[model samples]
Target chain A: MSQQETVLFDAQGPKARRRTMIGTVIGALFLLALAVVVVLRLAGQNQFSMELWGPLLNPGNENFELVWGVIGEGIVNTIKAALVAMTLSVVIGTLIAVARLSLGRYARIPLIGFVEVFRGLPVVVLVYLSVRALPDVGIDLRGWPGGQVFWGLIIGLTAYNMVIFAEVVRAGVASLPRGQREAALATGLTNGQAMRLILLPQAFRVMLPAIISQLVVVLKDTSLVVFVANFDELLSQGESIIRNLGNPIQTFTVIALLYIAINYTLGRLAQWVQARQARGSTAKATGGDDLVPVRDGA
Target chain B: MSPVIENLDLYVDGFLTSLSIIVVAMIGSLLLGTLIAAFRVSPVPPLRAFGTFWVSTFRNTPLSVVLFFCAFGLPELGINRTFYFFGVLGLILYTSAFVCEAIRSGINSVSAGQAEAARSIGLNFSQSLRFVVLPQALRTVVPPLGSVIIAMFKNSAVVGAFGVGGDLWSTGQTLTSARGYETLPIFIGVAIGFLLITLPAGAVLQVIERKVAIAR
Candidate 1:
């Protein structure tokens, strides 16, 4: 059985092994050719020239200062928008999730509709509509600094992301065995108390990793504010830099790298949280057995 | 004709353009994503690393950043094209990462026993994967793929910001500027149009998912 499992094939046979090796070589060659073509094209356009790249590299250069200043402000604005939206979404999402989970069909129906519609609609459309419609409907936020566009973006992001978070939270709560809430009730806790004290805490733990990853998604999506809204998030800042500097490649490259860095860090943190949770569960399982052995041996 | 009715042709044309872009980008991403997923699960170390690198780099970067690079950077590199071309290209490249991930998870869901059985019959890796693994994997993956496609459809809106004409987004912008004060009605029309496309697609996928759900 071990041998059968170990060899997924009949030791690949010599002929098959040779065929696999040939296939690998061909695949490598194809990739190399594609890379070479791209490189040559870029080189032909003088895209590799130091002149196009020097300002980005030299820290003290005026161009470097200008680009970084705008990008830095863009990053801050992006973070601000993302944080405000994320906070609002989480609060609203939790409320909706709980209402859907605990309330009657009459109450749940509207919340469900809210989630489905927002989830179905494209976020850009929502953002565009918010930015345009809010002012028209007499909610003139233009009086405040960056108020109209900022609030418009935040509202749109919140509406969309809140629905997603609602689903995540609901799924988290649903995954718990029915016994948990029932047991909490049996312990003299009210329904609200059971949910608030027992079910939600555990559900929140289960959903934390997903929530963090969604936050990263929200951060990436803040770039959408650049369109229809007069927001200078990183992507728009990169565009402005390109317009001024005539190096679209370098400017957008920096923006992409900045986005990747922030998002990658958050992604890694989520993974770490997931890993820790897995480890904790396993340790608990073994600890139960280990306690028995110690008690018996002693 | 009412304003919305008068602009019906523009909306229809925009819808068709969006649909075409969606069709092209969806197909491109699916094919590229399957290839990347294959690389990810391949026995070759370097291939797996490359696949990992590709998904990480593309997935973390914003779609707009990718679009900006493709639209502006490609032109600077002497690869000038219509905005539609670069827009669809950017959509495909960015979304393929997500598709790769969804499919990779689907591949993981396929039982090891199934692969073992295929291998025991002297089938090679590609052959077994193509004939046995992927069919089952794709059935489980329909739901996630639906979400990815929907996401790509939504993201197609971003391309319009770069002046790619004849999409719902651009049409909305045109109407908004044309009427100037009818922003509310024009955007409501656009949102409804998107909802019509997406809601049906989602319903159909959910039906398919339920029908094909493998009983464990």
Candidate 2:
């Protein structure tokens, strides 16, 4: 805003400065008053009492470690699902992208259909389908070491995100000059070999920031697994702790903060990389900015 | 087939709920988002900070969490409301951030000369923005705005899942989990329910994009 001042309003004179000063104070007071009202309301409900908050966060509380231990397990399960899904989505999405690009028209058409359908639906529906529908087909995930919920979550996340990543990869490749593909083909390389040796590497570099940021979306989407057949991810664990300790507000606040902390860090990492890549091409060319809506479940 | 037919009324009711959700939240977010975008670009430092804080907090938090907070946290503060009200509020709060960023970036993309020319012509900031810059910026904004709104449409699914009961995902889940209906057919119905909302929306947005596209 400092640098872009010319667009909105010019520098303020003394009277105008006084007006803005009063505006700022009023704004601050308004926000502060809202906070006070919330605090007062919570206080009336005895929400600030130590008994409500102790078991989960207070170190001296005997149940603190026990509660956190369960949450720690939930964190592990969430990370495990996120990591496995992220790895699979990236690898399979790249292969599918290459295949979609290099394949004949007949093959590409259905691939487009598959991508479109999976991309369009909410991921929880897919997760629910894998959990329930697959079992009827004798593809039971129960015997898997991670349990049905974990596998269900992974499969759904992978299906939705792989298509998104495929488009991202394709967009990256398309952003390059046409000569890169032609030059590789001119050197007597097969199409697959040319894409493998030439195009994909450059595309990945150009797509690094978007790919990293998509991981944040992947991590956030893991929250959807909270309802996937009692998976005990971060959210459900928060629910259980609340049931035991009788504090829905504090427990969910901690859980929300945990998600924000991890996601905010990853979001920052993507921005740092984007900043480094700022000079190369516009972020639009990547088509996978942090704001891109390929995110599953929210 | 039997299960879907049996629950046909529930499907209609739930989907209708979702449709209303899209309409209500779309308008809510757009109006709120425009205000925040204006706040972000304004010369006031406090307003800019407030805008930044709001965007970062919502954008970083997961939608499920936001909805969860609404479902649970608001009640704790004695802010009682219907599940439907809370769900819509959460959607508007979470989505307005994305809309703000899209508009802000659109505002930024408008060439500096336009604002300068507006000022020279004696139009003030809001006047220039309303008359000249925003109209141009909105043209560039439509495509991304479309994506954001579609994303919001899809996210209404979370509203149903998070205890705001009357939407397609929950309707399907109740049929399958409680009533012991067939999962495959119910899931298919739910997917179609979502597609019924999203596909037409996507087509409409594409049409709007073509109509409003600027050469620059």
Q: Choose the strongest candidate by lDDT.
A: 2
Error of 2 at B135 (Å): 1.8
Q: State the fraction of real interface contacts model 2 keeps.
A: 0.55
The TM-score obtained by model 2 is: 0.93
Please, what are the lDDT tens digits per residue for candidate 2 over residues A1-298? 7655666667789988999888888888887898899999989989888888888668999998999999999888788888999999999999889989989989799998888777778777777677668888778888989888788888888987898889888888887778888999999999889899998988887788788778888887888766566887888788889888878888888888888888888878887876777665564454335333333225
lDDT by residue (B85-140, candidate 2, tens digit) is 99999999999988998888787778888988999999987799799988998898
Worst 10 residues of 2 chain B by lDDT: B38-47
User: What is the lDDT of every predicted structure here?
Assistant: 0.78, 0.82
- For model 1, state the Cα shift of residue A258 in Å: 1.2
Predicted candidate 1 versus true structure: per-residue lDDT over A86-184, tens digit per residue: 999988999989889888978778778778888877777788777778887888877776678888998888988888878877877777778889999
- Candidate 2 chain A: worst 10 consecutive residues by lDDT? A288-297
How well does chain A score by TM in each candidate? 0.86, 0.92
Among these predictions, the greatest TM-score belongs to 2
Candidate 1 wrongly placed segments (more than 4 Å): A1-26, A142-146, A282-298, B120-132
The true-versus-predicted C-alpha distance at residue B189 of model 2, in Å, is 0.9
